[model samples]
Target: MFMSKNEPVSSPEALLQQIDTDRPLPPLEQWNPDFCGDIPMRITRDGRWFYQGGEIRRPAMVKMFSRILWKEGDRYFLKTPVEKVGIEVEDVPFQVISVERTGASPECLSFTTSTGEQVVAGKVHPIRVELDPLTGEPSPYLLIRYGMEGRLQRNVFYQLAEWAESHRINGRQVWTVSSEGVQFNLGEG
Candidate 1:
C-alpha cells in the first residue's frame, strides 16, 4: 500500500473505522514508513495546531491529525503506511485538559486530553513530574498512548496536587497520588 507522500493509502475515515472499541487508537505501531522529510505542521505548547504559518482552527481536522502523530526519540512526525513526515512540537503532543476521579476507597484518576481522548492514570498510564532546575517549577504529564505523553494543564495539575497525599520518603516530605494501587510522586512538599 505504499504511495507518495501526498497520497494516503487509506482514507482517514477508513483508517478510523478500522480502530476497534478495545483499541481506541489506530495501530500506528504496525506502520513502517519511509521518512518523507519535514512538514509545515507544528503543535504549539498550548496544544494549538499550525500549518505553514496559519493556525489550523478546525477541531475535527486537528484531532484527525493527532491520530497520525508519532514520536521517535524526541522528534515528532505524522506517519502513515507509506510516508512519515516530521513535525515540530513545542512541548508534548497532547495536553491534558481535565481529570476525573472514580471509585470509592482507592480512587482512580482518569484524564481527558484536549483531543477528547480519555486515559486512566494507572500502572500503564503513569503520571510524572519534572522540575525546572533553576525555578523549581513543576511540569506534570500523563502517559496517553503509544509512548506519547499529555502535559497536564496548570489547573489540571493543581487539582491532582490537591488530591495528593503527603508522605515521608527517605526523610523527605513527598506529595503523591495513588491510582490503581500505583503511587506517583507529585513532588517534594
Candidate 2:
C-alpha cells in the first residue's frame, strides 16, 4: 500500500538518515516481498505523482515515495520492510527542476530534482541526451541512483546548456559538463 502523508515523513533528511546511504542499501535486493497488487499510482513524465485519477499535489508525499522507490529488472515498486507493490512511471521516475553552480576544485553543477534529490553530474551521475525518433526532440537524463534516472525539465536543460563546454573527443566535437571533478560528455551535437 502507498504511504499516506500522515506518515512520519516530515523531512528529506529524516528519510536520508534512515537509509544511511554511507552504507549499502538495506537488503532490498535480496528480499522479495509479496506482491500487494497494483495501485492507481503513477509518476508522469513531467514528474507529477498521480493517484486514483488525481494529482498527488503534495511535495512531502512525493519526496517520501521517492525515498522508498525501488526498481527490479524492468519493473518499479514502492517497497517497505514488509511489503511491495507496482507503480507506473512514464519515462523516468524524477524530474530535474533546477540547476545551479557549485564551488568545487574546478567548479561543478548541482541539479535539483522535484523529489529534493541533489545529483551532481559527473562520474557516478553521468548525463546523457536521447533524441526522440519520432519528434526529434532531445531528452536529457541524469542517473540518480540504483538504476533510476532524472529527466531534466526543459528550462533546467537550458540552464545546463549555458554552462556546457564544447570539446573534441575522439576526433569528434562533443559537449561536456563537469561536476565532482569529473567530465561527462553530453554527446556530439
Candidate 3:
C-alpha cells in the first residue's frame, strides 16, 4: 500500500489490519534511508510522544506516526513509502503500557503498546529484560514486530513480575515467565 505522507492517516486498527500479523512487518529492517536530521520528535521513557518541545496531545497523531516508526541501529525514524526522518528517543522507542493474559489456560500473554499495537508473548513476540550497567535496574521489553521492541512501563513490568517464577537455568537461578508453553527468563534472581 503506497501511502502519501500528507494524506490523512487512518485509525490504528486500519493501520494494523493492513499489516498482517502472520506476515512480516513492512520491511523496516531492510530500509536504509538517509537521515533527515532531527524532527523535533521524541518518545519519553514513559511513552508520551512529543513534537517541537510540546506533547503531541492527540492520540490520533501519535497513532499515525507510530505506524511508520522504524528503528535503524540505535536511532529511530519515521518512514513512509518514500520519505524518512530521524528523531530522538529519550529511552526506548516504544513502551508497553498494559498486559492481558488470554488464550487457553491463559498461556498467551498480550501486551498493548503506547502505539496501540497488541503483541502476544510467544516466539514472534518474546519478552526480555536487560539490566542497566550503571543502575543495575531491570528493564523489560516485549517484541513489537520486525526488530522493534516496546519497553514495558514500570507498573507493567510489575504486572509481568507477578506472573514470573524462579527457575534454575544452567548452574544459576533465573526469574522466568511462561506463555504458550514457552518459558522466558526475565533476569537473574
Candidate 4:
C-alpha cells in the first residue's frame, strides 16, 4: 500500500548514525518490505540529494540514507525491514568524487564516492566506459557494490587517461590499465 503524506516517517537521526562511513550496511537484499510510496528525495547526477524541492545539505544525512539505498531493475528505493520508499535518480546514485593510485607491486586505482564509499578498481569492482551514440561523449563508471555504479567525474577520467598505457586488443589499439593483474580497457585509441 502506498503511504500518503500524512503518514509520518521516523526522524532521520533516529534511523541511523551520522558521519560514520565505516558502519556496516543493512541487509537490504534479504528484506521484503512493503512499498510505502514515493518520497520527494532525488539523487542528482553530481551526487547531490534533494528532498521536497530543497537540497539535503548535510553530507551525513545523505550518507546515512545511502546506506539503505537499494536498486531493483531500473528503479531505486530506500528499503528498511518494515517498509520501502521509492526515490528518483537523475543518472546514477553516486559520483566518483575522487580517485588515487595505490599499491607499488601491483598498483591499483582506488576510488572514493561522494558518500564516502571506497572501491578499488579490479576484477571485483571493474571500471567501464560507455560512449553516447549521439554525442560520442565518454561516460566512465565504476562498479561500487551490489550492482551499484558510480560515474567517474571528468577530472578522474582525465587522471586515468593520463596513466593509461597503449595496447592492442583483438586487433584494435586501446588504452589500458592493470590492477590485480587484470587489464582494463580505458578506451579505443
Query: Which numbered prediction scores highest in TM-score against the true structure?
Result: 4
Point out the higher-scoring one by lDDT: 1 or 3. Answer: 1
Q: How far is candidate 4 from the true structure (C-alpha RMSD, Å)?
A: 2.6
Which stretches of model 4 miss by more than 4 angstroms? 1-6, 16-21
Q: Scored by Cα lDDT, where does model 2 land?
A: 0.78
Q: Tens digits of per-residue lDDT for model 4 on 1-189?
A: 225346765777666553255767777789998888898889988889998889989888888889888998889998877788999999889899888988997898899998888889999999999999999899999988778889999999998899999987789999988776777888897
lDDT (tens digit, per residue) of candidate 1 on 56-158 = 8867767877888898899998887767889899989999999989988778998999888988999999999999999999999999987889999999999
Q: Give the per-residue lDDT digits (tens) of candidate 3, residues 52-115.
A: 7888786766776676788778877887555577778887777888998898874888889876
The whole-model lDDT of each prediction reads 0.85, 0.78, 0.75, 0.85
31 Cα displacement, candidate 3 (Å)? 7.7
Candidate 3 lDDT for residue 154: 91
lDDT of predicted model 3 = 0.75
Clashing residue pairs in candidate 4 are none
With candidate 1 superimposed using the best TM-score fit, by how many Å does residue 119's alpha carbon deviate from the native? 0.4
Candidate 1: minimum summed lDDT over ten consecutive residues — where?
Answer: 15-24
Report model 1's TM-score to 2 decimal places. 0.87
Reference-based TM-score, model 3: 0.77
Report lDDT (Cα) of residue 50, candidate 1: 89
